[model samples]
Target: MTHTPVDQADPPTPHRDLHSEQGALRGEHPGRAENPVIKVADLAWLEFEKPDLDRAETFARDFGFAIAARTEEALWLRGTFAGPPCMVIRRGRASRFIGPAFRAAERTDLVRLAAATGHAVRDIDVPGGAKSVSLLDPSGLPVRVVHCGEQLPALPEQEPLLLNFGTDHRRTNTTQRPPREPSRIQRLGHVVLETRSFLRTLDWYLDTLGLIVSDFLFLDGQRRRGPTMAFIRCDQGSLPVDHHTLALHLGPGTGYVHSAYQVTDLDSIAAGGEYLAERGYQRSWGIGRHIQGSQLFDYWRDPDRFMLEHFADGDLFSCDLEPGWAPMSASGLAQWGPPVTRDFLGANPSPAKLREVITALRDDNELDPARLLGLMKAMSS
Candidate 1:
């Protein structure tokens, strides 16, 4: 007797409100590359060109970075972590963000990356001697992949204050007093950038440096088109790393948005924010827990108007987890915090921003009329 064959294909999985488990099923781009040139270890440092080195150093100190090295032409800022400096600010005619540098896992990775990108590996002229391969992203931002010969030794850091939780008391007699000082940044957490060619730039980093997306945010009504913002992290195999080492979002202009540093805890963020406010520095946003990374954050503006964040208790993910997809909205920014600020959103109208919008609309890049409208809707939503 002949038996009838039955189809055993599983039904399609439905997308959840918080995350989409099946990217391929939804016709979305996979968050990683099959064969990348190199897998970078972490973000080494961010470079900036500032006109006033003295003013920059003052802000750096106030923002909780220890001066790793200072010279007549440049200043190197570091955290308490034993690694490369968190930032390098060079004296220049104007104050602007130069770009970010990623640390390669091995010297051979740098060689492989250089060979694949056709860029020669050159020596980095910073505090620690290093070899780097420099390249420009699709949005014209300079990116460096460096393999450093020496690592900066860990410095003394402020300890987290003991606290009493629900039914669990750590401190019995001590008063709950955190010092009114800088939050004492532990390490650079992540950097966020705005780029006109978001997809191209995103693909470049994933393909070249082997970064993977931790989360993806798509504009309202533009899910089919693709994600407009991506929180990307380094691929460290089974080791859990920061939810985002770098984040990129599509915008009319290409520039730095903000950078985050890890602080001890909520008390540190609050006390540090108070210290900054007392010093006449502007608070952009925060003292709230973010939804994506689950980090308690406080954003402040430096003297030069660059935004930096003091964050703590961020999520970490291993390489096995798939990227989560969510809709982009202002309300979705944080789990608990004050309403998102206009300054943090770049909503304050400016002549330079107006000019950028006009130029981007007229250009041949990715920012189009519909895309811009979707972005605007996303911001307002």
Candidate 2:
């Protein structure tokens, strides 16, 4: 979405009780890698493993992805617009998120990445066949960089409804009524993940992908606790990009929390949610704008119970912007909406997952017990 230029000069900045400078996370660390082979351009797609390809396809199509291609063992789903598959579902016994893939800014970046990471550039085995090199993050999550892929041409988009305002009437006669259709998702806006090693994983992403933090959330009233979550955007020079292409949260286990897709507008999100509800799908949370990225969002559960969001009118950031810091809590999740759900907060942490988190804390020093207690206090507040 495009908007008229507004006064950006000395914009009022949001306060972070505990704030770090924009590049604070990029400072030298003894064990961190020295340099990235190349920076990525944008997020591409997410990989998943599911036992039932048919069920995944049904939910994906209803969720707004067009079937890019289908094989007996795999499924490739994309948004209405043209691009490489935005999602890949592979047949497997267990259902889980595999990882996320990114698009490289330059084709040569792939060669440098493969060489630097000691992984050979290999052919992508899904829709829009492309060459890619894969790397693992600090938490051992697979991240891929692709040199090239087919761009599916744009489909007919849903035009925004001309709405009349209290003071200004844009529509003179016609009553506004949106269709009961899956709000056409324009593109994948961002992928949010939960990781045990929040700081290490956050630093790894910042250092390697050249991603810049847009916002940092920490324990309320505990500025000394450090950042526990991040909303990060791609570094695209002076060009404005989505406020966040990726988000990370500190949680009991490491895996996908949810992925957000862009719709046309508020109508798209609401009408789309209604369509899904009419189809008997569960609404996870949303129909509200978030404070961090400022996206009007609506979340739903897919066939396999993975969360997918339909969002619109999100904020975009220029390279000149600095990171904003805020307190993290369930109540802080949105500016206005129904109370945040337990599932969204990763509440009721299983004993096994709790043990995994304890192990990660014992082995890696990201936060101390005081900070952890502060984090718990913030969450339960």
Off by over 4 Å in 1: 1-25
What overall lDDT, based on C-alpha atoms, would model 1 receive against the true structure? 0.88
lDDT to native, each model: 0.88, 0.77
Q: Deviation in angstroms for 67 in model 1?
A: 0.2
Evaluate model 2: give its TM-score: 0.88
Q: Candidate 2: where are CA atoms >4 Å away?
A: 1-36, 349-368
Question: What local lDDT does model 2 show for residue 239?
Answer: 92
Q: Over the stretch 20-50, how does candidate 1's per-residue lDDT look in tens digits?
A: 4553323466788888888999999999999
Error of 1 at 292 (Å): 0.9
Per-candidate clashes come to: 0, 2
Cα error, residue 240 of model 2, in Å, equals 0.5
How far off is residue 63 in model 2, in Å?
Answer: 1.3
